[model samples]
Target: MIDPVIERPRLTRYARGGGCACKIPPGELEQLVAQVSNRVGPAVDPVAPLLVGLDGGGDDAAVVELDEQRALVTTADFFSPVVDDPYDWGRIAAANALSDVYAMGGRPLTAVNLLGWPRESLPMELAAEVLAGGASVAHSAGCHVAGGHSVDDAEPKYGMSVVGLVDPHRMLRADAAKPGLPLTLTKPLGIGVLNTMHKATGVVFAEAVDTMATLNRDASAAAVATGVRAATDVTGFGLLGHLHKLARASEVTAVIDRSAVPFLDDARAAAEDGHVSGGSRRNLEWVTPHVDFGGTGELDRLLLADAQTSGGLLVVGELPGYPIIGETTGFSGHSIIIR
Candidate 1:
């Protein structure tokens, strides 16, 4: 009654760094980019202007004006498996990559697969399953997964490079958050901890899986419908990490209500049990100097900095169902203030 294939080594074991947490530390990445971000390059007549450049802080994707009315939003995201199920991992990665486009108020147009695999170790059948899962999610978004590239590697990896279209005037920019705007996070935190625990214990968490795989389409639509101009999806950078970048870029201070923030079931308990990831710890350290954690404790801090994969949009204005976690204020030494 047991399938020998399922008895093979768990997928998580092959990964060196799982999910978006695999990204380079935010501090180091900024330092490296600061050195070359201003380099001059050969130029020609431009079809469109760069609306959201990397130098502007933490935009979800790059946008270029395609015409007087529409702009192209482009972003790519991929990582090793965060969960053991190949199909589920594929779905999560696809949703994660698509979030960047949605975060910019764009409708996904097309995506091409990006994969890394150890052909000798993993069967082609399993790879097909992963591709099928990704295709399913992309199809649900009404986006085409036309083609892709693959390479042989030690660890198996998957994701997509997505392109979408947005209105030039209505696109959300990370730098657009103003001093008086309220911050509303559309998803719960602690996904990193939950994932780490799952990786270590092999316990399946249906809720976290469902959360990561769910697209931010509805939330993005809500933000655009409400006329919001500033938004960014919480991904590799935890809430605190991304919020710090947004606040600093906008030259404002973010005041977060410690108790108002939401968390996935047992996320705090997992953190309390020491299930935090190295990436989450790095996020905490990177944000420590900028946050005033009035009465919040270490557990809360870790949860706030928990690295997320396919997280939700942290929009500048309040929406119907999302919780208002914070508000923005004029320049302060601290980028974030927890009360």
Candidate 2:
């Protein structure tokens, strides 16, 4: 149980943008990348062939072939606090960082902490709690956490850079999605709005915290075992935004059944209370051109595009226990169609 007395300084107060919502706008990021890629050209390394990189519409991680059967998956993710409790923030950030490896059908081998603390303002004890939380979660995932780098900064930040290994044959790729495959989401949506509410009203949502802190390892293992090949975890971009990236990369159209999508019990209520984040609004606007919302109400659309923090894997193929919220179809001008 969290001690109310010890939680004196609300961590969320220091964060300008909370969790994945702190990420740069997807549209602006893509444009910048496109320009840089055009000027720099493809980065070629003769030593180890890059199996997956930015050229393929930016996957969950950068994978490089290490040998005939194995490949190396590397990714880094960090964000500002999404919750008031430093320990929970650390766990959520660690889970979010490790998720990239799992999303690629890889098992994390090692990780290094990435921390930015306001040494002058926040107490160092809080940072220790945050690191301890991250370490505990990493240990549970069977990933080694070596010493990491820290910097004195204005706003406190935390996450990790993870290295993992995957079987090349069974690896999941965002660009591998194909038409006719069912889209399966392993977790529910609405984390963004709930977090937004929490940051504003100081009401802790236990369900949302658990959802964010839970690792995606089980879902990823299930996907690999089930012969699934295309998947990506939902994060700052939200479901619709991430789905748009997957569809565009695979040259397919994703058809989402709004009724079938799952949500937290109070997600709709939170959204109705105007707890939506600016990043979520930006997500909807960015994907507006590529998505065809068929009679879906504004509230539902906003919920669909609500930016997630440590969200779930949006797999292109079905899993037994998860819900099939949509299916991929041949491209019909638009990349995504919500009905």
Candidate 3:
């Protein structure tokens, strides 16, 4: 048991970059991954042909078919605090990590905690709170969270590595979108801006906190139930970045209606107040060349390209409770058309 006498420090203070915005830039990551993937060459599978490989075809999680009917899905994700509350931060991180599995139409089976702590500076009790938070969410998903490895680090980081089960025939994929299919986003955008504001001023927004901590299980189940095959979770890459990837992989173009997109309360206000993060701005820059920003301005672009943490699943077909923001079109020179 952890001692209760230890002092609780402000967790966000130790974070270098908050939330999913800490990820490597999309453009640079693609270039570096290309070199590594080329060096490793194609993987040879004697049992079953690879359904999704790293060549920009796979969606969130990697899947290996175990049999004609079953497949194993694996993914890992972690980040520093996006909010000040230790428990809430833990919940948000766990949900974000598990989202990859769900996006692939898999149900979590087991998870292992991934933690980095400044043991000398922060008390172990606080870490326990974080752990408890993660375990609570994992339990809700009917997943087992067992003991995991922890490292001594300068900052506090938390998340999980998850394994899930899926049907090989019903799995959702990033490369399966078709022309004329409607696009729907399960959650609102602007998380990155809200998080930036929180990091800067220590002000709390309950709505953003609740949104981030919520799991994507229902959304995933809905996507699979509705016979949707193409989907990707909107996280560090932002909506536009992920949309660009979806369109490119599916060999189609995306047309998003800027007016129809939804945002968390005060999200637009945060961006208008210049609370945007560098990661979010980078997302806009990466997709600028490929997007047609017809009448959209800087604020709208920033909101659309805002880097998000545990954001939402962007599905090709419509599902109940989600807004239809765009539709797929035949391949065009521009990958994204924002009007």
Candidate 4:
């Protein structure tokens, strides 16, 4: 438990960008990847065939076929603080990192911490709290927190590198979406705007924090059990951005029912009050060309594209307890249509 006597430092202040919002913009990242892929050329019959890597719209993790029944999934993710509380920030970051494995319909086996801290500015005790938080969550997920690496840096950062296992035949892919399938979202939107508001005003939004910290384990299990093949977590890119990626990769167009989409209670209020993050705005701008926002206001559009941290899985098929936000259709010149 955090001590009541000692005043906690605002960790977000140390970060130039919070959470996954710190990620390189998707548009720019694609260009860099294209150039690198061109030079690397194609692998010619490797020992273990690569099931998924930096291809097919950049799936959640790199999955390599281990055998007929199993494949190995590996992914690494880290980001600066998103909340003022170090422990909560740690939990949120861990969940976000583990989410990559879950998004690909895999179960986490183990994780190693990746930490960057400024020794001169913050006490080592605070870092311990963060690590403790991560360990606690990983334990709950039944994943081992074996060990990790740390570095001294100007700004503090924390996350993990995770390894998981999945059945090669049952694994999910972003490019597996087919026309006529419903889109199911496991969590609500507006986390980015709420987080932006929290950073600016220091008002705690417990719901948003909980949302980010919540694991996608159950959702992933449901998708795989239901035989849903296409899925991706709603993170840095936001819903519209990720949907566009899935649609483009699957050679289909996603039609989102703006009204059916869910959002946190205060998400709209925060956006209306101009509490949106630059990353969210940038996400909107990046996917604007491919998105047909019919009769949707700018504010609604911004909310839809709000950059998320450890958001939720956007599955390509319906789930019993989740909301069906939209459906996929044959390619119609546009990657996403919001009505």
Locate the minimum summed-lDDT window of 10 residues in model 2.
Answer: 1-10
> Highest lDDT among the candidates is held by which one?
2
Tens-digit lDDT track of model 4 for 1-339:
123345677888888889988899999999999989988887787889899988865899999999999999999999999998989998999999999999999999999999999999988998998999898888899999999999999999999999999999999899999999999999999999999998887888999999999999999999999999999999999998889898999999999999999999999999999998888889999999999999999999999999999999999999999999999999999999998
Cα lDDT of model 2 by residue, 89-184, tens digit: 999999999999999999999999999999998999999999999999999999999978999999999999999999999999999998999999
Q: What is the TM-score of each candidate against the true structure?
A: 0.96, 0.97, 0.95, 0.97
| Candidate 4 stretches greater than 4 Å from native | 1-6, 42-45
Structure candidate 2, residue pairs in collision: none
Cα-lDDT of candidate 4: 0.93
Each candidate: what lDDT?
A: 0.90, 0.95, 0.89, 0.93
Tell me, what's the RMSD of every candidate? 2.0, 1.9, 3.0, 2.0
Error of 1 at 60 (Å): 1.0
- Pairs that collide in candidate 4 are none
Candidate 4, residue 312: the lDDT equals 97
* Candidate 1 wrongly placed segments (more than 4 Å): 1-8, 38-44
**How much is the lDDT of residue 60 in candidate 4?**
93
Clashes of 3: 0
